[model samples]
Target: ASFSHSQYEATISWPQIVAALANNLYLGPQLGIDEDSGYPIFNADPGRLFTPLTRAEYDSIAQRTVYHPQSQSDTLAFTFSNLDLFQLPAGAAGFAGVVEYGYQSYDLKPDPLATQYYYYSWKDSDGSGSRNRWAAAGELRMPLLDSLSLSVAGRYDDYRFAGNSADKFTYSAGIEWRPLESLLVRSSYGTAFRAPDLHYVYSGVGNDETGGTDYYRCRTEEPDEDLTDCSYSDEGLIRTRSGNRALGPETSTSWTAGFVFSPRENFDVSIDYFNIDMRNQVQDLSTDRLLQLEANCRIGSDVNGNPVDVSSPSCIDAIARINRLANGNLYGITVNPVNVARERTSGVDLSAHYRLATGIGDFRFSGNYTWTREHLFQQYTGDADVDEFQVNSGFDIPRNKASASVSWEKNAWTVTLHGDRLGRLPNSDSYDQIVDTEAGEEAWIGATYRYNLSTEYRFNERMRLSFAVTNLFDKMPPKDPSYPSSPYYDGSWFDSMGRSYYVQLTTRFGGGPL
Candidate 1:
């Protein structure tokens, strides 16, 4: 049996810039217009037409710019294992069981100024909520034959939160066969359930400033401009988010089959294929996707000016989430978490390892590769499936990813080298529409690879020193101006840091002495 507790707290603050205050209803009139341009002129100088805030007032409001949010969790679990039910020629049948209980809670408290929108910050919602969960599981392994084994497990989970409750049962079964001393085969099928996370289910309404091209706004304001080559920059757009208490658990079914081949000692190769289908995936729509949906609903067209179904449920939700100003300008967007129809993916994984010992040192080489066969996603029941590999489909995941490493160990020193690679990806999903435009040059960012090197020295049984360098060759992410976002690269897939180095010394001492 075990018990554990965890807690997290954060105090966040945002700058109350003069420009933001100038846009406030109470101050916009006081700050007069520019005499020459006839537009609102922002000036800090007191004698100018614009009236600026006093230093004292600025200081007073700065003190009220902080908000605090905190979360805590307590968990307890009990388990019983190593109970042999019977004996077989190969081994004894083993069984195990476990039970777990947990409680989690969170509180989001915004500052008075923020709650009242006294500054640039939006009026954030405030609330506190909690949940309780219980789980039980059992597993059994049986060696029915000398060359084969089978195992099965089952689990049940129940969750209660915010006047709502959900329960799920999951199960898995597997089999393994060793037909020859050098080869082994295995296969498994399983089902899983994931309850809504504490923060995802209980977080209060909040707003953030994000950037995305408002397609509807762009087309409405610039009817004569060519949108294909348009680099319409839209920044500091508001995105509001809030949690949902009625969310159900996400569930998945998965299966895998694999085999391991070991013709000799210290060397092995393994290959596996796996597929998973999930339902009721809980997630929040990204800013770009949300805006695109809104445009499709309002303008009845896609980015390429193609007609789309505007009467669908997805379109209805999209239109409702977007708020507009008096002049039909975009005011903000709401992106609450909701359950999507389904997501499915299948892939194959290959791994190989070899070890060699020589008079001077021991060397180990290993490599792994993954090939994604398919990835399908549907946001709603009638929505079309989105293929991840298709260009301009909004999912830019490459089909292949791989890593390889080599390590050598000598008397007291160990050195290692490793490399990671990702297959080519289309520069942007909107590349086709802009192919004839000026921003379109490279259609794809070729396969990218990065390397790392590390060395370690052991001074004694208890002391060691190590040094490492990442991106050993100082590789840079390929430039793609056609991509919509700034920095011209996928920040999610690449790091802007050119090269990094680190060194460390570690020592271990007994409780009695150093």
Candidate 2:
């Protein structure tokens, strides 16, 4: 039996904001007029305007600035194993089994003064805010035959928050067969579950200033007007995202089968086919969907203009009146995260590795490639499934990706070269409203390739040095006009930081605490 415990804490600071406010530099309200061109400030561009604020105005804003925020987490675990207690028949008597239990707690504490700044979206707590969860797992391995082995595992988790609890059970099984001295085949099937993260489950209420057409107002303006162009303007909509205590866990099932071949002593290759089907996927009710629902309700029709019941669960859930103007106009709508979607994806992964020795050095090469055949999603159980394969739609998952690396080592010196490729992704179809709005175009995202190089040297056994250059050729990411505010590139899958170099040194010493 074994046991362990750990604790961690971090402090976050916004030095730039503090410095700007202290120096009375362009951190306050915009000027009423341009000082240089003598023009009325229709839209004061902060980048071009360096106007300073009055002493009182600067102090007022500075008082609300948050200099520091803190986050902390704690974990404890215990494990037991009895595999060495028994022996099996044949040469495969190395059976093993293990069981473990663990608990973790996370807390986020923001400065009280920061909560006064509405623009910061700063979260506030009356006390020590924390989230906790517990997990237990067990695994067993056994050799069923001279050339065959089997394993099974299971896990259970419980998320506890205040007076609410969410739990789930997941399991998996696997088998391996060695039909030949140089070949091996393996397969596994598994089930998994995920609870929504704290940010999605426990965010504070805040207004998000955004630009989009309001479908409800548009429908009422011109009965036959195109929904896309009506009331299309930047609006400060009151948005609230809070923890859903009743939220359930997202569940999924996955299976994979593959074979490994080593026809040569120093060369090997493997290929695997994998498929994953997920249900009860946790996601926020998109604002676009909410607007669409409101439009349908006003028109007494569905997305297809078919007459439908307005009081249905889908419609009622989307139609929320969170805020209203003094004139009794609807001011804001509520959108919350819920378990409502399903996803299914299938793909194949191929990899190869080879090693050889020469007089000057030893060389090693490795490569891996993945091809996504299908990526389908259904918003709700009653909705039709849409294939997003090869399309940068909802999640922007690419259809294909690959990487290769070569390394040479001689004496105490080593060098390596690596390359990565991301296949081109097609824009979502016009019918896919979510993607159309987010990406802004129905064109393909150009393919991108990047390279990296690194070198390492060792001085004796206790010290070593390394240097690396990422994006060695300074390759830029493909342009996406839709993301002009975000450096014109998708940071999720592409490198936004151009060429960069890094150097590091490592040392180890054998001694007592000193």
Candidate 3:
């Protein structure tokens, strides 16, 4: 059995706690666990495992303890996962359950990214906000109709935000049927949701700072406790913390229908169509939309043909910062949101596999492909550009992406090959949604290979491993300088982490069972 337990309390200023207990804050020699709060505090910077702290010891962070360091945005998130089973009754199905709980409490911060200088000093009471969620679910599998199997799962979550709480329900049902020796059909449907994160609702102005300009944000929304009145702005866009007390959870409904065909052990194929529709999608107001709303809110010509104001500039500016309203035309280019809208996402998953045994002794190979077409079914109508992928033509989708892998295994040796092939699809930016046409990037292929040998004897297990490379064919990412540049985004999307290779050894201890 595996079990875990955690005890955490919200401390408004954890940085101060670290400062107060650099070496040993509690238990007379042990660090952290203040006399009253009894919580752990870190004073040192935890250097990256992959990226070591490049700079030499600096006076500013000298007191930071390597073992324990304070996070800019403090959080106490707990995760617990475990699985145990009751042997199924030989001819009867059995049951199992899973449970999880998470909690986080953070302090208020102001002008986080330096995006805006000093608007309303983001303020909060010590430990004024917290989040707690619990999920419990059970599953039961019952054999049916000789070659058919059925399973049902149900789950529920209880959430608390800013002292207020609510409940959410989700469930799933699935059925697998084999009508013939070579064919099988499967179907399932479920409900899903996304709760506003402490980061999204309460962590006001964060890394919203952009270099060339005053602000850099994922969405064009002003930072504030209320999300309705902000806009994404450059000159005046200031960073303020976000904290919404009454926001509800975003919701969605989804389903999948698929079929499989396997005539022989060497060949198997499957196709699945999946759909997901979400309501009240949590997204930032785009600078473009904010500007339109500020100047004129003409969503898509009204039912009756007439010029309509896209958004209210005055209304958008009042919620977050006062400094951003300086320019009249600025609102045309800026965006922010205190009361943003909702969005939707839907797509399909397609795949097939073929395996073969060759002269290489028990050679094994396989491949899979997926096609997803998404769209924006947001609260507002000006989502034309938002739904870029021409996928469904609705804005929130991406051209489909596919991936496949093949491998061979015999005795103690295993060799595998794989690659990701992005379809030459359209982009969110240009008149030509086709990736190959736009300068953003073109669909390219990347492949890799791994060879490993393993043998076990006595109480010891070991293996030798080597890797071929990424983009096996030296398939470089697409780069077209002709693509235009925008003040907010340059077309310099990161190329794939170029091809790479490595080798290593693996070891394992002998187990009690044989």
Candidate 4:
């Protein structure tokens, strides 16, 4: 029923500097070398660093690259609904069945330069592949009594790609009970599956970089200097990553129980509890953690000077994946994705909405909040569970989060305000060295909030104008001195942009009243 095609192209250019040659020419005079009589220099050779006399000479060293990639997909689907399965005491049992087929292909071509390394340029590898998929699903719903109903569904999916294939079957069931007109209860259990991402399985070798203070090296080489004052932060070491075609599909089982309360037609609230158990989760070591593990492998201690077992599998793997210079400086690292043991989490969700009509205008209020009770993970079957819900757990996910909004509407105008609260989290992912000196306690970034406001006006049945402001108060991200990386804040959760504004005008050519 649908088909899509996409194409992308990019051109990149950069300057490649010969650091040694430049340094030698600039420092010639300091080293007592006078290759050029009147030229300024400060310690090395001039013949080895002569400037290019023509554009052609300079072009030979300048790096340039072109990359193009394309992809296409097609799908056809059919569904049959409202078919009667059987008769029940209160209603007729209805069934629905669906069938679908899809095919997709992508050509991910990297530039020729991507295979070669430059003094300051990154490297990348090819990722080109295609896949086809087929799926079938069915659902049945039955009403046994006037106030209770039940539903069940099942699905099967098969995928084929690059000399490999995977197939899975999943199912779900749910029950609902409405003892009163204003109250309802529901519960559900389900099993789910996900195929490996195309890029995760098809991407070849790639290289990138990250920068931070090499704490282990600094501590060993400059034992007299305070760690906070160490001046080792510089250009990042090289890191290489690659994909794996042997990755298996991820599977999970989830259960949920919830209830809805509606005391009046204009007000409602719902609360739900959910738990999930996942297996064969695919992942790779984060840059921060990788660096931390590298440090641990060499020093056998955390930032706090606590002892660590350097002979463990994690440390052994870390040592094997990294290469070091003769002076013990980091040279390169290899990080490949792999399937891990398990991840289990449980949480509660609460939401409510209310609407009121008054002489001034119609007002609506809505709010939602989530609380994570527990989060546990294991890297291997026999490994100990790592608790991830506590403070300073080295995970970005917060234990609590909430949002609220209010809106007002009149004859031709509407206005709304919204706010979000990002819960507290550790400033650094490492296990130690975060403290408030005066208070003698660990320091953390407390809850932060942002707000937005918008207003809209309708000029006619088909035209409207709108304006909005995000981060209305221009709140800045919290600063943490203990963070190891540059721009010492969690960029993943917060935006550095202080404030933003926008305006828009919309018009409809053929539609109902606005």
Candidate 5:
């Protein structure tokens, strides 16, 4: 048995410029006359802009003071194991078990000065928030036959926040079989759950960027315009989003089956298939979905022939729009996270390795590839699922990826060459429409490939030096005009930093007991 305890704390302070940017201090009210009406525009209505302030007035309201935010966490854990309690007469024990328990508490406190300057809905009485969670887990493994094995595991977790508590359980089972001397097969099925993180569950108030069109504004431009057709005229919106305490854990079930083949020495290969179906996937409704729901409520019926009540809590919560301009131009909309979506993804993975001995050195080669067959998502329980395979809808998940490496070692020197590839991705229908309207044609991104080389030499038994050149060709990412902010390419899927070189040295001197 073993036990442990730990405590941690951290503090963060922001500069004057950071605070000014966060608060949008550079944007003042408009003071000019309207061109269409030839009328003086002033801060006279809720949606009207305020008069532009002088430099002195702007400085007085900017609040250039520093902000010091702090957070702390405490953790305690206990573990027990009895894998050696039983032994077989042949000296080959085939049974094992283990158990563990842990608890953690977290607290966050914001700077008083920051609270006065920022616009947030936090109302903690003492300017602090806290939450605690505890979990217990156990696992067992046993051999069912001379060439077969089985394993099972389970875990339970309880979380407490402000006087409320919630509990969840997850479990999994797996099996392995060696039917032949050179072949092995394995399969596993598991269920998992994830509680909302502190920021997702207790973040008082914050702002986020959302992509969608303003229905009211769009209708004014074209009387018979459809909501789906309005995306061409929309860029995006900034809005408020808050955490929800009533959220529960997101759950998922996954299964995998694979086989390994080793036909000869120094050579092997493996292939695996995986599938995951998740329910109650925690996510905030996108601006487009929110607007669609609001439109459904206004029509008194949903697409599935279900009745809709405009005054219901769900409807009211889903619709939040602001018109900052007196002429009724939408500035933004609000959204919050909820456990309301479903996602299903399936894929296959392949890997292989081979080794050979040469006159000068020993060479080894390995490669791996993954092909995603399907990636589907449903916004709500009763909504239809949308396929996102091979499309880049801002999720950053590509349909195909592959990598290969070759290495050679001789005496005290080792060298290796590696290559990586990312398959092409298609744009979503709405995004495609927006691009076609702006550029007069359809757009698509092509595949990308990168290479790297590394070398290492050992000076002695205790000293070593290594060097590496990443992105050997200094290849640049492909351009996509659809994304204005990052028109170069998808930074998440491709390297935007270009080529980079690195060198490392290591030395070890300690050999005696401490």
Candidate 6:
């Protein structure tokens, strides 16, 4: 029931230096609806509709019914990459160094009311820009010895949120060692910070079509005044960004260690473990968190019923949904992500491959398996709802995820297959619930085949033709509605390609070689 539309214009201003650097600017107007095609015909609430919304009425609602973007934006960007080799000492473990950098800025024309679905009522009284970010980074690799290698990289970025901004600094380091011809080991540790994207930190957008969440009352104690969305149980009655600013970027400290073992030229096995702990994780009160907030902002009472308002309304609903973590917050002060004490994560990956030669042809295959475990560490409610939640209020992180593929190539023909699996996500947003995302992922397989047909016609030349069929089986991906939670998944490849075909023909430039 969701739809989106975008109109774009791109201008490239590259000169003969084009071979060295390519630069361009993209301008476009975009708008989209990320919700279902209106409300469910059978699920509409009759109480709120003074007049009930009939099935016909619901069906009449249009999907992606947003206005064309009247405000335009331009992303000015370009990349310049080139490498030159410089050998170390003559017979020394030969090594070369490389350096590259890229920069881009997303600028949008001023449009205060730029929003999705033309959702504007006199009630919505704010305007902001389309979100964008700018970044620059560089990296270098060096062979320190015949059996050792090292690499270093760094990046600095600035995220623009309307008139405000946030800065980011990231770095990475790695080294490899080969103690013997057949035994190799490598390890690395680095830190990186992820800036909040447009989807979350900027372009503030909210919907209350459903009364699943509650709001805070930072400025009001009265019942009839314009309290600025402090409602506990009303839909479309509260808002969080009415006077709010964008949030800051989150930071992460990460490290990885792994080794590769190649017993034979045709077979190899490897394993890697990674751990990352993010601080000031940039999570906010989405519908799900808002629901949790109700519980957070609630008021606990004693046997005499002494009234004590809870931190906020989010806690009440969240505790309820999560299988009851008790009626009130044991922690007296309201807890929030920004105010959030901290967040951490850890995981491991295992991948292997084997190849064999047979009279009929050649056979080879590979695969990777992963395991993950996450913790909100700072806040583990003894009474928290673990089974019903996929994400904690402070983070949207999966402890583990893995994907694998197996394939064989024989002459001109080849067959391949791949599959990815995701474990149960923790503390998911309510959107996850509405979309039914607990289902995880479906196993999918795709195969492509290429054939070469050539016939000799000259002394030493022949015409050759090649053709390929992609997604030959057309196996549609699992619709389990859980797992990856992506909007695109019909037949795999994530909107890139479906079952399709292609062909091409070629001959020697001088038509003299076979």
The numbered model that scores best in lDDT is: 1
lDDT of 3 by residue, 84-146 (tens): 233333345656676766665554432132223221222221113567777777777766566
Give the top-scoring candidate (TM-score): 1
User: Model 2, range 1-514, lDDT digits (tens) per residue?
Assistant: 5566666666665522343344344434545777896755544356735666676756554543343333455556666666654455633333334444445445555555544343343334322335677778888777777788888888888877656677888999999999997999999999998876666566555444333335556556654644333443223455555555566778999999999999999999999999999998888766544665566665777434567457655655556533546753456766667886788999999999999999989999999999999989776666546566523223466789999999999999999999999987643222223344456445567678899999999887878899999999998878774442435566567666779999999887864321
RMSD of 6: 14.8
Please, what is the TM-score per model? 0.79, 0.73, 0.59, 0.77, 0.69, 0.53
The lDDT per prediction is: 0.80, 0.67, 0.47, 0.77, 0.67, 0.46
- Give one digit per residue, the lDDT tens place, for model 1 in 335-436: 877888899999999999999999989999999999999999888888767776655555667899999999999999999999999998777545244444
Q: How many backbone clashes does candidate 2 have?
A: 1
| Clash count, candidate 3 | 52
- Which parts of model 3 are misplaced by more than 4 Å? 4-91, 103-130, 206-247, 292-327, 331-342, 345-347, 380-396, 424-477, 480-514
What's model 5's lDDT at 380? 62
- Collision pairs in model 4: 26-42, 27-42, 27-43, 27-44, 28-42, 28-43, 28-44
- Would you give me the overall lDDT of model 2? 0.67
Candidate 6 error regions (>4 Å): 1-137, 158-161, 204-206, 211-245, 296-341, 358-361, 377-400, 410-413, 424-514
What are the C-alpha RMSDs, in order, of all predicted structures?
5.7, 7.0, 13.5, 6.4, 7.2, 14.8
Positional deviation of 69 in candidate 6, in angstroms?
5.8
Tens digits of per-residue lDDT for model 4 on 249-293?
A: 888999999999999999999999999999988887665566666
- The global Cα lDDT (0 to 1) of model 6 is 0.46
Task: Please state the error at residue 461 of candidate 2 in Å.
Answer: 6.8
Clashing pairs in 5: none
Q: How would you order the candidates by TM-score, starting with the best?
A: 1, 4, 2, 5, 3, 6
**What is the Cα-based lDDT of residue 113 in candidate 5?**
46
